[model samples]
Target: MSSLAVRRISECFVKPQFSNQICNLTPWDIVMLSTNYIQKGLLFKKPATLIDEHHFIQNLLEKLKHSLSLTLFHFYPLSGRLVTHKTQNPPSYTVSIDCNNSDGARFIHATLDMTIADILSPFDVPPIVQSFFDHHKAVNHDGHTVPLLSIQVTELVDGVFIGCSMNHSVGDGTSYWNFFNTWSQIFQAQSQSENHEYDVPISRQPIHNRWFPHNCSPPISLPFKHHDEFIWRSETPLLRERFFHFSAESIAKLKAKANSESNTTKISAFQSLSALVWRSITRARSPPSDQKTTCRLAANNRSRMKPPVAEEYFGNCVHAVSAETTTGELLENGIGWAAWKLHVAVTDLNDRVVLEFLEGWLDSPFIIQMGRYFDPYSLLIGSSPRFNMYGCEFGMGKAVASRSGYANKFDGKVSSYPGREGGGSIDLEVCLSPQTMSALESDQEFMNAVTEFDPLLF
Candidate 1:
């Protein structure tokens, strides 16, 4: 084998999830990894200061163990292979706190609210501190090339700061939400004199039926899909989050526009917004003269399924919704038509076939292993309305903003309900690549368009 073969083949074991992962670097791997994983993280600022809540932060951690415990899941490496314990285990991430006391002349202790902008800027939090995570993953990997989770914490006097660097192999958004929400409540439980509310009791353990989903095959392990390509890319497409307040009339119009018997029953505000985003993203990168590409959306399935999951059920409960069309056709079709496509994609999510797949996943002892072969480029842009910083009624005031756990990825999240500021909206934390971001921002028309959506643009 060529030296290039070793680089491609050896690194293929980046995670133990995907068995079908290319044994050696093929042209396909190059195209998939380079095009899809190339994007970087974007800055989202939501400035918030921590008040006197040392007790709040402390109490949160202790309660966390009752529901979820943070401990390392030892992935033993034998010879050239790896093995993960076959069980739903405690989280491999830990939480810690960091603080700094700056006393100059300006009365010095004024509270500082960190914004979405500050959170993305790693500089706000020093490297040695960030390295706490670096050390954890480094120590856990133990000279091996498999992924591991090592979480660290930083606490401030005015407030609490969180810094996470987890191996994507272990879990996704659904998994993180379970861990983070539990952690959030732990802290929220503090600053108050009463018991913190955890999730509802588990009523049913979903049966894993691999046979119904596909041909009779052996049950797979965790980490099912290996990462695939970025499904789509544009040399100059920009992405940003601008809070939009819809008038009663406008929202009604959008709702009517999105509503259709074919739609997934009731088209929601998120479904409508998703439709609009798909149109924008697909058209943003128009094909040469007269061509286009496929468009896709991601949906969270916690509530979509029957026997709706409890508020506290932790783990990934999401799947992708894909729609294909050319840039001209999508944008030309207008919002309503595109929304129709989104609805169809989402509606398709309800089929028994979908549930069958979930069963296999739920039953899989080694899900992380199975995910290795999963397509990397498939777009699954998603939203989490549950992104409520203010609803964090755990103890103190609400958070300035809520967002996804991962720093850089095509997937997106937004939370809206109410805010401390009267009817105020929070910014979505977006981490995009520099090139695309610059291109997206340069379009003055796009910037102007955001305001148009905001009737109060004047």
Candidate 2:
């Protein structure tokens, strides 16, 4: 593998449409201040008709930057910086986005002498993939100094990779992917138009007004005087990250088996899969039979709200719904029981539950930290199989693979992506301790359900 080389780095700002805009962070956003940045990327095969790699890359970079500038106009908050203010009387801290002094998003261009196959062929994701993103160890609150959004475009020997690192405090997974999809739409529109400077209209207009329950106000101040009081920084443990592919057939089987064994029809495909993962990982770890294990999943609260928020509401609108059980019961009762438990947790997370969580946050403001929110004994699942990960063509072609950075990675962190084959198939990006991962690979029952993929299929 040849060394990676940096070609250029610059800033891309939103089109000058408006000025002096400021968005206050709500409790949903405030809770994410101490969390890791959202880092994700897509892989695209180089155009076959291209002859001059240098010229192709240069043109692609320019178009991407321009399209991003246009996209940022709709997502202007992304280009702004997080401003922290200290209140004297109350002696608290407040965070907000200052659009007037926007620094714009960071844009990086680089080149690598490796094929797309080199990235997708491995069972274990190559560590080099992490280098494609910026702000590796930074948290969301670092948006004050670091750009709220960072994009890195790496030209490969046979393909290209577009990686982005966005402040988690600015948005959740829904908001993250909405920005991505709109950006790609603008890029593709530019490619087809004769005018290089054409401004395309966005398909879905984003709603910037932060959501909060009645009687709850903006500028929610935290009790801490300094961010360091709640900020968490720890050494990451040795872990192995691998992609587990579940075909549509396998998904059906899991769902059917779960529902049949539980003797209920309320189980969903996601719940069934989650149950399988929870049980399998528990069995692999072989924890004490009486030990308590938990699984927390990020649930989108848009539809769960009484008066549902628009799908395009552009901020954090998710809450972590969790299920807990004893290792002995989870293992003995089988995947159906485990999945049923997950279903109940999700079903019970109605509008009242979401309102309660927000109300409690108002009384006592705090941020999510590593050791406090998650640990090795539990699992934290984020992202969703429904996201249009493969739809980001950018006029080059359909994405061949999807990857994420090491910003918020920890043992038992799982991110889900839509499978390349589509049609209800799903791919899980699982991270676990080396010992647990080794055990998971050797577990026949779990491996039997995973769909084997040929590297060339990617």
* Full-model lDDT for every candidate: 0.34, 0.86
Best by lDDT: 2
Identify the runs in model 2 with alpha carbons over 4 angstroms from their true place.
1-19, 90-92, 195-199
Q: Candidate 2 residues 189-299, lDDT tens each? A: 888886655457778888998887797777777787788898887666888999999999999999999999999989999999999998888899999999989998889
lDDT score of model 2? 0.86
Q: Candidate 2, residue 260: CA error in Å?
A: 0.6
Model 2 / residue 21 / CA error / Å? 1.1
lDDT of 1 by residue, 185-302 (tens): 5444433435433332222322211111334233232242232212222232233433433333444455566675334447765556556545543333434525535445546665
Lowest-sum lDDT 10-residue window in model 1: 4-13
Whose TM-score is greatest here? 2
Per-model TM-score versus the true fold: 0.52, 0.96
Error of 1 at 258 (Å): 4.9
